[model samples]
Target: MRRAIAGLLGAGLVVGALAGCAPAASDRPLVVVTTNILGDVVGELVGDQVEVMTLMRPDADPHSFEISAQEEARLRTADLLVSNGLGLEEGLQQHVDAAAAEGVPTVEAGDLITPLAYADGDAEGLDDPHLWTDPTRMVDVVAGLTDSLETALGDELDAGELAASSAAYTAELRALDAEMASAFAAIPEAQRALVTNHHVFGYLAARYDVAVIGAVVPSGTTLAAPSASDLDDLVSAIDRTGVRAIFADSSQPDRLAQVLADEAGVDVAVVDLFTESLSEPGEGAETYLQMMRTNTERIATGLSP
Candidate 1:
């Protein structure tokens, strides 16, 4: 009986030791990303190597989306925090700041590319945070992000895996860039004017040789309201440009775009694009690549004669 009790105790100790040795899902290196777009990109780059927590929900506005207390606490625990900087995360800046203060490593996609300023709008001259509109720029972001993850995660992440994944995704981005260029090149030069719900396509415009006639909101962020004069100015611009379609963000209400179209009185189409946020699965833009490709097709169709 004494020997049996000792044997049972020994087995229990062995089981406890094995349980302690196996890492829990939470024990994986945590990467807390701010926007769903960046989160998708990060997931592509890292695969199953880390736990990615995307703070912004699908179709949530990055400029105004808020996080709960649980998410705020989780931010401090992040091995690395990836964000779309350049004043884009207006509502979550405080939480990002707190996470950085706690010494969590951070990589901002805005810092990876040559940021464009709002050409015209109330936010003119401010850096545009919508750099992901251009796939070539996104290739740069993936490169920078891969480097950051390798440096921050160190032995916790496999650098070899990171490089392989980045290369594959970068190739896809280059293909996407070519695809967008080809599609937009088909738009008649005279008909290459774009009017969006907001000034969210400066990077896309610059990359594709399309003109941003103006935005209904006349601001860089959807959080800004359009005044009577702003809408009046945009309406006049649309009349002069003969814009065939006005693009509105799929994540935002298109009532303003509809109003602008009604006021334009020019049989203009109100096309929806996944501008800032990814849509829910099967709603067309579950990934960053999908979002860009969908927008490319929509824009090409909208502007083509």
Candidate 2:
């Protein structure tokens, strides 16, 4: 009995040693993405081939969301770190930079597209990081992202499958762009002006040939507070432009937009749009494509004469 017990103990020790030697990051390649929107896009592109860890939660503001220490450690170890650059991920830039410094492959979606400048507001002349607002621009981003992912994860992932998936998604984005153009074209030209909670729709406006009169907050980031003069100026523009609605981000409180609507003294409707982040499941903007489609329909309906 003593000999048998010793043999079992030796076997147990070997099993424990083997368990300790197991890979910490699992068998699949890990991709750590900063924003939920980019996370969704990467998931769509990669499917189930790799593990994708998204930092931001649904409906969370990209400008102010944070991550825990565990997440930061995982980010540094990611095979690829994807982010929306041009200062969109304000709170997480330091973490992204640290991950890049550690030699993790990094891809910024904004860096992939043709960026548009803020035509007005506190962010005037600065590159607008909201590239996904225009599906055409997003196609450019998706193409670049495909190349980056192929280069970074090709050894672990099937390059042919990755290219096929990207091509399929790119075709869908082109269809969405066409759909948006048709919808917006139906609205009268005089009503083609947009007033949002902030400078969130510059890319969209530029894409669909609409004018962005102004924003209630007068800035690109929602973290910035609107000054009294900013609101006053936007209200005047709303009155002058005769815009039918004020588009506000659904994730953000619409109180400022409501106040601007009331101050404008017009029968302006406050339309809630998924401007920054995707919504929770069944919340009507769960996916990036769904968010854009819903916003397109709402914007077309709101502006139609």
Candidate 3:
């Protein structure tokens, strides 16, 4: 009778252990993305395969946006963490490090793309992390992310479906590249100069054959401040380049751009572009493709003869 009771107790223990090990809500593999642009791309690539949570806001500053405590905790549950490394996510590095220390697999998109250097002047030859400004470079990002998702979450996601989604999204990015080429070609050769709020347009200018005059903030990262001489130098460059317009980020304050334009003493138009971040839904630059297209149109119009 004691042996029979012991056997029953052993069976109950096995049942309880199996029940405890059953899937819970948190069992769903989560992907914690650092920036909204990457979030949008990952969403397109993975579709409904894995749960994706982006830490940054749609229009937040990538160089300085911080995640909340709850969001940091969410990082703990993530199977994969995708970030814009190479000093882009300046304010969120500590959290990313913490998450990685906690055993979350991390992928930095900047490592995948051939990063451009800050053209001339300050921080010249420093690796610029703003690869999204060039849609073709984003092709590399998409390819790397596809492989990363597979490596990180293949057990939880369907391999075939993920590949299909990634391929389709990459095709869309290529179409965006072709569209940008056509749009920028319409601008006169002499009028292809760019003066932005900051030095965030290196990749875009490099890819499209546009000459970057100079920037208000003359550095690759936005965290750096411009001095009085810096502003004066940019104004002189703007006047010399005969740049019709100075572009500023839609998400950032454009007072500096306006100041520089005013300082230039030319009829420089201050235009806004979705340069650094994506916009909210129903807005002009809500998606990555939409952001690139919208910027291309604005740039073409701004620099047109």
Write down the lDDT that model 2 would get. 0.92
Best by TM-score: 2
Ranking by TM-score: 2, 1, 3
The estimated TM-scores of all candidates read 0.92, 0.94, 0.90
Q: Model 2, range 132-188, lDDT digits (tens) per residue?
A: 899999899889989999999878999989999999999999999999999988899
* Clashing residue pairs for model 2: none
Candidate 3: count of backbone clashes, pairs at least 3 residues apart or interchain: 0
User: How accurate locally is residue 10 in candidate 1, as Cα lDDT from 0 to 100?
Assistant: 100
Please report how far candidate 3 places residue 6 from its true position, in Å.
25
Model 2 scores a TM of 0.94
Per-residue error for 35 in candidate 3, Å, reads: 0.4
Identify the runs in model 1 with alpha carbons over 4 angstroms from their true place: 1-25
Model 2 Cα RMSD, 1 decimal: 2.6
Runs off by more than 4 Å, candidate 3: 1-26
Clashing pairs in 1: none
- lDDT values for all models: 0.93, 0.92, 0.88
Tens digits of per-residue lDDT, candidate 1, 90-116, equal: 999999998898899999999998898
Question: Best candidate per lDDT, number?
Answer: 1
Q: Which has the higher TM-score value, candidate number 2 or candidate number 3?
A: 2
Q: Residue 207: error of model 3 in Å?
A: 1.1
Name the regions of candidate 2 deviating beyond 4 angstroms: 1-25
User: Model 3 reaches what TM-score against the true structure?
Assistant: 0.90
Q: Model 1 Cα displacement at 223 (Å)? A: 1.0
